[model samples]
Target: MDTDLSLHASAPSPPTSPPGPKGLPVLGSLLDMGSDILGFFPKCAERYGDVVAFRLGSWPAVLLNHPDDVEHVFVDAHEDFIKNRFFWRQVTAIFGKGLLTNEGEDWLRHRRIAAPAFATRRVNDYADTMVQLTSEMLDTWTPGEVRNAHADMMSLTLRIAAKTLFDASVEADVAAMDNALNDITREITARFSRPFVIPDRVPLPGHVRYNRALRRIETIVTRIIAERQRHPGDRGDLLSALMRAHYDDGRPLSDKQLRDEAVTMLLAGHETTALALSWTVHLLSQHPSVDERLSAEVHRIIGKRRPVFEDLAELTYTGQIIIEAMRLYPPAWLIGREAVKDCEIGGYHLPSGTTIFVSPWIMHRDPRFFDDPLSFRPGRWTPEFTRQLPRFAYMPFGGGPRICIGKAFALMEASLILAAMVQRFRFQWGGDRPIKPSASITLRPKGGVPVRLHERENS
Candidate 1:
């Protein structure tokens, strides 16, 4: 499908000018946009101008492709928008009224309840646990080994989350939690495309998978809560902290609410961070100069010693590399919103109940703001470069009050793991196959990232 919405089109009428992509009568350019999720954005920008309009299921969406436009949507007019139900309702089906899916008063209440535990000092406190778990993961790996970086990251992050969230030390129980988290993620991904398909009542695929995942999640979360109730101790993990939290009206979280929150943190906490770490390693493997620069920085920061909480500030370049990797391949690729009332944006009208989509995968790489947008360049994240960039053009953890509660946790975990990995090891690509972004709730490497991890000769 092709759209020619130019001002001068075969001299048709005396027209004032505005830029927009002309969509096909029905399907629009969605089919031409390709099947791969992240692959379509750059192409869309090339064909259309910055604010490109398109459609999905008869709902018109304006893709904000410039930094200024991104700023307008997220920061300037934030209150007018909220998380689109179409995208999050599937997640809410399992996680319930956890922080990620709710908005308005309920969201604010939950965020306040969850805030104390995610405070900066508390996140720093969890660094020790993150490092310990990361070291444990590395100890299992032999030097000069070929391994799936993705798999290693998943297991490592799950362990960190397990220890950090519940303070649980049982290996078998942790393994079970990891397995349950995986099943929940898979189910969430499947439900996105099969939105209308009724969940099975009995042992059907969706029903069976959903029930099994929910049961596993509930069993673990309930057991932890019960133990805390039976013999409360302030272990400094999130669960223990929440255990002591009370809402504004002297109300505390209900048992179901606690379970929902545990499910939310366990699933949201580890999954995206794992993907980001895996991608950072993969990008490092492909870009040797970058790898060399990062290795030098890591070695200079902590010679023959593991990273501590204080190391995060001095490891500026390492943080830049992670930021750049997320910019190139943000784990949470697409964010959506729905309008609750009639609204006008960029001189066009959007109706009440309209579904809106905002894709970071599209905006982060917009050429108007970024030079050589598709290329991986951590240097772009220097303090000076950061000051010059528009605010909402780079939101890996989202924006506004609804921004990820676990952003600090994810960053701390990533910085520590990346710094630790680079201090002792260098990774090289295992093959020539291109790693594509596969968006399924989170942006994942379509297949898997295979890399060779060789211990640094002189570290």
Candidate 2:
């Protein structure tokens, strides 16, 4: 293959650099990036320049560290660079071709149908649902005691997603579903990073566990879909909306498509929001001033009442806290793409079939963009400050034509849950250890975040 590393076929060029990381002769840099890959790009940034190129089994890989270069990949030349099939292939084992996995026309088609269901009004309608479910979760939370905040948030948000999206609460079976989702996400993550794993049905330890968990998830999702189909539009939740939705050609989604979408929403809708909220609370716990301000905002806005959609605009600080949390720990940390044709970005030649990674985790915290990048300062996200930041510098939910369909829904849910939690409890760190980042699909605390919750008294 004549690699077309050129802006113009005849243009002169700088000398090509050697490929990054001399690993196993055939495997190249995959092992290096995969092992201790949690903050792989940051370490790479410290070593390489803003735009670093490497290889994974002869497949070219580029990691863009600067905001402008990140834009050049996701927004500026989006059409030319689609979601890498390999990244989606891992999800393909379970989700088939849901919105998150598909590319080109199929992605566009699914988005067209699912997008309206996540409209401002539709998502706003979900605020009451979020408040109602969160209130129920809070009823169990006796304050002034220590508990695993991550587990609590995950449980609460998963229930909210089930109720709001499916009109079906997991009830006693929620734990089983949670465990299954966690297993599946971890398995898929391992698969993505190590692509040479044997067939999942081969009964290796990892494959055995992963396959069993996937079957459980499929069974649970299918039952929910079948039950919802029987009762149909009476539910008035996301399942009903998707059940009623039609493509431009008047085609409703198939059972497989429906199942994929419902499960995707179940995982995507709740997991990321819970992770974001968990980190938000953890950050606030260490910064009493931020937590105090947030508590005051919630108290003044709702005053012992449940939150309403109308309260969102007035909940400005709540929104900032969520944005800042996402900046620090974006649930979907890395977005990957593959080039279909020769392209030139930032004066560098990108040949066809190159794999590219744009990491929100790195970009949002890049020292070039954020002052004191590691600090937990919600005030930094003031309206004016946000306006001054680069457009693609902080895409917690991602950007371009493939932006998160549930962006509106996730934000509303996060803010509502945060307000609902703040209205009652103040989180205090239960452990002296610093929170560490871990990932399977969503960014999560390495171990669950434990916090002592204290109920606010006297308003």
Candidate 3:
């Protein structure tokens, strides 16, 4: 998105407008973006350097690709940047005023309440459930049958999310919840990147489907919330944590607030991790040597035992594998924010209301930071290399004060699931289907990661 620093408070000298592609007429870069979002931004960054200017219809915006700039926006001046007002307005229908969309006091309160539930010790409690649920899912897969890894991962993660977050067994609700979520995400993503923001109330076919999906999800969420409230004790679930928490004034989270946070966790907890696992499986299938190394690593660490919480620390290569896959196909691909006040990002002055985009999609592949940026090399993450790498250069969970609170939990979940699955099966690329990355709300495999399952040789 282009910026005119003239509107903001004056600097001692005139701000130099950053160089960018001369977009076509009034439509700007919308047409190019429609064709390939992942390619478009990276091309701009490659051509124009780190900070690139463009337009999403009429809204002025800029893409910041430097790690230092990323640090400035998300860390140094986080208060001056909040969730993009334009984009968040579209998702509030589904996300509500939960931590995903809320700001200031409400966000702080919700974060405070939800924080304890995801504490390292507490998150460790869910490992048994994650492994058990994954094992149960694997029970149904037949050797030599080709299954969509993404679809299976979605189902497995949703079940894990339901059980771990709300302490409710949702074996029956998985299919319905997944279908509903697909519809909702399709419609919201269509709206989010459109030439202009379309109001949700409009009577488009997708809008109808989106609303129906929302209602289906609400019914399921409402059921979970009601069930939790009835058995409202310390169940070691997120809902219990929120219920046990009180506001500064001693009031508890309302049912509405609880529902909002529950849905947020439900979507985030499952979807992103599922994508990460799905992509990891895809990577493993394509890179047989990497797959062999990971298989050996998991076998060496876990070796015929169902994984336990204590085993996580030993899964070093397994952790690196997940991190590398995310670097390539980050589920949360782009981070969008709006400047609430005039701020200098990467030495350029951006005015209030300017849409600022930080895409991990572009950053992860920048040659300046990652060597042979597109290669899938897990070994690049040596402790010395990680320490020497720029802090914001490798932020899959984002950075600074408002970073994803679920970082530890998500990484642990992914490592556990990957280690368990890799140890038991060898995935062969199902040749019939092409798996392409879909940069929707979360980056997902467009056609699903199709792989022929081959159960391993030893126990």
Candidate 4:
């Protein structure tokens, strides 16, 4: 009820705009934002209260830092807000009109078609594949050998996503796919930070790289679709399910629809989860006690055996660690939505076309909702703590109708993979290099986390 700014209710004078820092003329905080995107929100909130207004170039924007305000945008008045134009343009450029980018009935239809593939039963079935893939990756590691945990994770999860979703082996194409994904993410991020006038069609260096990446991705997806078409059957994977799916009117998705959905799953389904695992490993390396407890739990539960789907429920502490890691460094750190109609939120009058920003990175660490918010304490995720907390306070995968469709899958995948890896190897920071979090399409370690692997003797 904190944001119950109903227009019909009796009001006390006209509502004033939220307070924020005044920046340089025209550019308007753009330089500061680009300098440290991750730190910008908390700085604004600390200085100007939770609901702070700012400008992205000349466009007016507001950062909703409180969980209740986040709830209003994501759940209560969600219908009035749609994906922000700036962010969606970049996402749609790569993902096309898939579930992640589509809106309205198209979104609903696509959601329905894709929903079955990620059902509880289906995701549980994928747990074996998750463990299998993680174990395969671990087999290549040697004690005292340094590795880029982020790259290793990206490669591992990409393969799992490919096999589980498409019943295809992307091992041969992993390098190509990884390079393309990196190019696209880098290009889009660059576009996001700069002024908005530059079109993707223009022959900017980044744009050219982005288009090339797009072609590479299209080639991969197109090849997969063509093969599936040639010899179609229920392969018991997402692509097969999508191919078999039919609308209420008995029509099927077009080849383009299939391609878009496939590529969306390929990009989103792997990258975010891999980043989560990488950060978890980094955090675990720093916190030895937490790591010890996690190892103990994994050994006690699975003990020299691969984790099964049912083991996920009993791996409660492992789940807590992943949850806490995401809380500290959520892969999807920021959520952007634009007002479709003039609306009031947190007592501020936001006109139509206003860009609304909600950041999990800031809200997750807000002292109001979390005790010892800056500390990395997996024990803090008790049932009582979660029950009392606002739902939006910890949206690592987002919230409401558009909440990540792969929530269950990501959790299960992360938990299973964490259990599998931690049971076999102990990771330590390879050197004194400080790993910085980069706020791009997903939160990633700036250079990549370098870690030395110490094989567990008992295992």
Candidate 5:
């Protein structure tokens, strides 16, 4: 049984400054948020109510828990908002002028160029590659071996991303890329906590690692872009697709533009899907009944064969398990959008430059929107249930036009990889202390989902 919803209920404060906990006078919620960022927001919502106002140092911020308000910022009134510069400026340091950082027409053009490659028909073509890579990795796993499933999923997804993007196996290049990404994410996480951030030009040791990581990424992406330019043709990979794209006036994309799009796809494409699968694997290990049900579904639908893109339709239960896991542990945990102009949301005044945070982590677990929100219940995702819920209530990929472009690509990739893994191995979570979430920008399993593998016998 779940906790009673009535016990957790609270009322919103009056419209004066969108009522919330008034933290320390000078530093505001800085210490509190820094100590426990994920738990802090919900605690405010629980006590101060839905439209909770808080501060991240001098910056005025608000946490909007309801889906209608989420819709306002993400969709209905998006034109009046921009990616919160406080956070995205740091992200821009890593992503450059990629789709993730670009806004307005520049963003539109890049999105237009890259969109075709991720179209369902086109994305489905990579199903074989997704499963093939998973199979290759599974072949390396020993039945009784203890392994970091998160690391395994990360490596496998990176391999798949490289093959699908570069049309070459980057197995040899994986370690360098992996190390580079690790350093980059670490540097960015450090930046997020600090209200007063040190400029990247400063030769701090962390900044040095940050710059070195950028160079490594640049080297690999540059090599691939240069090669593609020298031999430009449609190769059915993402890079080739971008290389083949042209502006309406017949102008070709600049080298810098190519670099931005490539790095964006290479990093964002693999990381999110990898995290989704990692969490799903972790959740399945914790609940054997759920795991067994998932295996039965995969076996029934796939029948001793690997899953193809077509099988995704019949793999409904497999899809639900992944969906439920994401609801429990969203990869892109929080989204920050700053208002460019004053606006009204939830019948309260939001002034210009207010950074509004709409966290999927908090919203997905709201008792008002979901019954027994704390439990891992995949079966709740029925058509009627989804239809009844507000659109933003369960947005793992986010909402609106600026939503993740790789949405189709990601869902397909996660589902296929998850289905394939269960078909081959059963995980046993032999733990000392329970694995904890290390949420910086994305929520990751702190150390990794370390578990012992028990290979499934052939049917």
Candidate 6:
């Protein structure tokens, strides 16, 4: 594949780089990025055209707002671009060389080993566990009870992730895992945004807390791997599949590799899915009519029984609601890539090593692709609407070879959890305060989403 923009094959010469806002000397647009991470791209795109060039600290960068350009980076010439070193450097300490952060052949090998665990059949087998865990959590809630919807979803998903992936009971480690994950995510987000932040090796206040949290996580993962090795039995879980896998060269994964992959799955598997569900509930609360439609669909398809894998295909409206919610508030909001060789994107000349930013949050809401882009309308995701849209317009799970490995697992898990909860309870706005989005490792509800739950009379 040519590094130049294949979408514009007829262009006579490479186009000049896109226009961007001026920034401070040395610091460039780093402060703007640090100040409002979520708002930054749209602001730039509104001022500049589809493609914008700027800097993050001393690094040369471009932001691609159009779906065609996004497709180029994520799919057309994927090999010419690699994961942004600066962005991944922040969490590589925690994730190591796991599939989420690894690159090249190493990434391929890890992906190959982990792929079977997420196959349609295997993911389908885990559907019952998702509904069972969600039911258990819902049982603890009372009608008219006020709850932080974000926290509730997080706790529920974490439990589901643990049980489904590791075949471990939630009682032993869910609390500690939750605390550690919070601290690690907070610290990583802080370091990633600020260009002038101190190095992790230096013992800053945040670094100290981050290290402590990391150690707790390391302890938990190490113990799990150790116990699994001693038993060496098939538990019908992801961990078992990974343990039993071997490379083409007849080599098994080392203990360190096992730990890294396990931690990556646990973090990525639960965190983003939980956030997606939380945002879905928040959107439903504000749009009661949409909620009614969604509830009615769930009732008609699932009735009072727990959701099953086969019911997913029949719950068309329920799927559309989740799709629309993610379009508005994608958990993995921004994707970054670095040009390994000079390239032209949307006719812009990008030099080697240029950092490129693609935001699903911005693109999904682009008025060009979506009608009334800001409105919360699940009905917009009809078959004709989706079929006619650009492929890159709705990428909550990303795209290409490096797209999220857990995409199927997450969609299934979210659908089941949403279906189960909606059938039993109806949520209402619990407070007068408006909730804002916080762009951290994942897009999260600022503070938390406070909502009142009313149990259904029939349920």
Best by lDDT: 4
Measured by TM-score, the strongest candidate is 4
Q: What ordering of candidates by lDDT runs from best to worst?
A: 4, 6, 5, 3, 2, 1
For all predicted structures, in order, the TM-scores are 0.88, 0.93, 0.95, 0.96, 0.94, 0.95
lDDT of each: 0.77, 0.81, 0.86, 0.89, 0.87, 0.88
- As a TM-score, model 4 comes out at 0.96
lDDT tens per residue, model 3, 33-82: 86788888888988988888887777778999899988988888888888
lDDT of 2 by residue, 205-283 (tens): 7777788888887888898899887777746567777788877788888888898888888877888888998898889
Candidate 5 collision pairs: none
Overall local distance difference test of candidate 2: 0.81
Name the regions of candidate 5 deviating beyond 4 angstroms: 1-15
Residues 1-459, model 6: lDDT tens digits: 675658657757657877997788887887888888788889999999889999877788988998888988899999999999778878887889989889999889989988888888888999999999889899999999999999888888888888889987656777788788788878877776566656787988889999999999888878878888889988888899889988889888888888889999988899889999999999988998998888888988889988999999999998898899999999999889999999988877899999999888899999999999999988998999999999999999889998899999999999999999999999999967999998877888987888999997658
Pull out the clashing pairs in model 3: 1-54, 1-61, 2-61
Clashing residue pairs in all predictions, respectively, total: 0, 2, 3, 0, 0, 0
For each candidate in turn, give its C-alpha RMSD to the true structure in angstroms. Answer: 5.8, 4.4, 4.9, 4.0, 6.7, 4.6
